[model samples]
Target: MIRPPALRPGSRVALVAAAGPLPPGGVERAMDRVRAFGWEPVAGRFCRGRCSGYLAGTDDERAADLDAALADPGLDAIWFLRGGYGTMRILDRIGWPALAAHPKALIGFSDNTAVHLAAQRAGVVSFHGPHPHTAEFPDFARDTFLPVLTEPRPAGVLPFPAGSAGRAEALVEGQAEGPLLGGNLSLVASTLGTPFAIQPRGAILFMEEVGEHVYRLDRLLSHLKLAGVLDAVAGIAIGAFSEVPDEGSDGRPTVRELLQDRLGGLGVPIAFGFPFGHVDDNWTLPMGVRARLDAGAGTLELLEPAVAERG
Candidate 1:
């Protein structure tokens, strides 16, 4: 994938709330974080506007705001404020041709997976990382966010904070080098048969989720299997699956077991638990950049500089 222009310090970045309403005190924290990164944060008008029960604004309003941000030549990036349930609502409304012509870094996770897939379709790389609302204002956000976004090269050997565990625990120990793809399993699976289905062949596929029952996770995996998504990857990495209740040794397969059962036979490198997902310390990963996944070493290293600096 072609990298968009790198966002330099003091660049103007737009903060958009394309999903749920911005929670109380959320935007302030994100703004502070953005300032810390040395970027001027231009909050979207819709970011603070509330419409229905959960959305930030009307579907048209959200889509239009995003369109304006993309079309603005001065905007260096479009960082999503938060993700809940509104992006799909404005998918078709996006002016794809315009976005393709004037690409910018569009970052977020969870509900923002739709936009990531859309960016891929538009032939631009999108960020699958924390949002300003959740990631910007927090301390761990600085540890992961700043390096990945501001540095000239993709950070090497993503390090998890102390006490945090990734999903794959020594499963299929090996290494993989390829572009990074995949996001929340449910979101990726939800795109099946849709035009935005994940295309992860020969790429390092990373996945994580939150608040999902083991059965639901299994079903999503089944969907990927049925759609042949699992068979087309070069390597696999599983992030933290949070909020899953303990099954109490009922003999039901855990999420990791299920992953191994489905992906192990592929003969590719597989590792779990990389300190990513819907959690604090969510490291920012560029979706289309080449990377090496060393399961034996428990590290995912970016193989190339994601952005080029023009002196």
Candidate 2:
């Protein structure tokens, strides 16, 4: 995988809204955070634009903003402002060749999973981390994120919070090493049969979601199973599925039971409740980088640097 240049102190970071419209003052707050990190933030032309009820702008508008950001050599990274929906609409519209020619770190998760999958298919590395609109930018998130972008070394060990019962558990205890892949479960499932569909073969698939009911989760997991994703992966890392109800009616299983029923028999190293989804301490994960999953140890460690050193 091609690693983008490490983000220097003065590097320009383009903030774009490739999905739903940004919340009021969302762009300002994001810009503030970027400046706080000592990097210059360049807002995309339509980053704050709103239209079509849910979309940030028309498909062409959103795509054009992203295309411009990717093509701009001055930009060291493109940090998505938010992720709600509409990414699929502009997925095919992105200039992949241009993006590949001027590669920069693409950061965001949730709906931005569409772009991350596309980046993987294009053989470039992107980042799955807290978006400006997703979290409150806790110290943990900043500490884990800034170093990966500014340093030229492996991200090292990523373990769940200490003494937190929400820490990851081994569903299938074992060890596996492979390039990290996957994102929001809903996006992963929705991309099936498309060019951007996640190819989990030989990858440590990481998945997370929010507000999805147990039955829906079951159906999506079933889809992946039937699609051969479960059997092809080197391992599995499950992240937070926040807002999923504890009960299901009509004889349906609860979220926990559904996860066990669907993924417990995968026979691969499986770690659940990883700290990378819609959580306050969402750690930045470098997609397409080789990483080790020690399910028994409840740890994921990147084996190589995610960014290229300055020449």
Best by TM-score: 2
In model 2, what is the error at residue 218, expressed in angstroms? 0.3
Q: Runs in model 2 with CA error above 4 Å?
A: 162-167, 246-252
**Stretches of candidate 1 above 4 Å error?**
135-140, 163-168, 246-251
Kindly list the per-residue Cα lDDT of model 2 for residues 1-311, writing each as its tens digit.
88889998888999999999987889999998889888999999988899988999888889999999999988999999988999998988888877678889999999999999999988888999988754388877888888888888997887556557645788889999999999999999999999999988899999999988887898899999999999999999988888876456778776667788999998999988788888888889999999999989888899989989876
Report the C-alpha lDDT of model 1 over 1-311, residue by residue, as the tens digit: 65667777898889998888888888887888788778999988778878878899999889988989989878878999988888888888888767667767888998888888888777787788888766334566567766666666868777767665533376888877888988888889887777777888898999988888777887888888888887888888888788887532577777778777777887888888887788777878888888999887778888766654533
TM-score for each candidate, following the candidate numbering: 0.92, 0.96
Model 2 clashes, total count? 0
TM-score, candidate 1, is 0.92
Task: Tell me the lDDT of model 1 at 68.
Answer: 92
Error of 1 at 270 (Å): 1.0
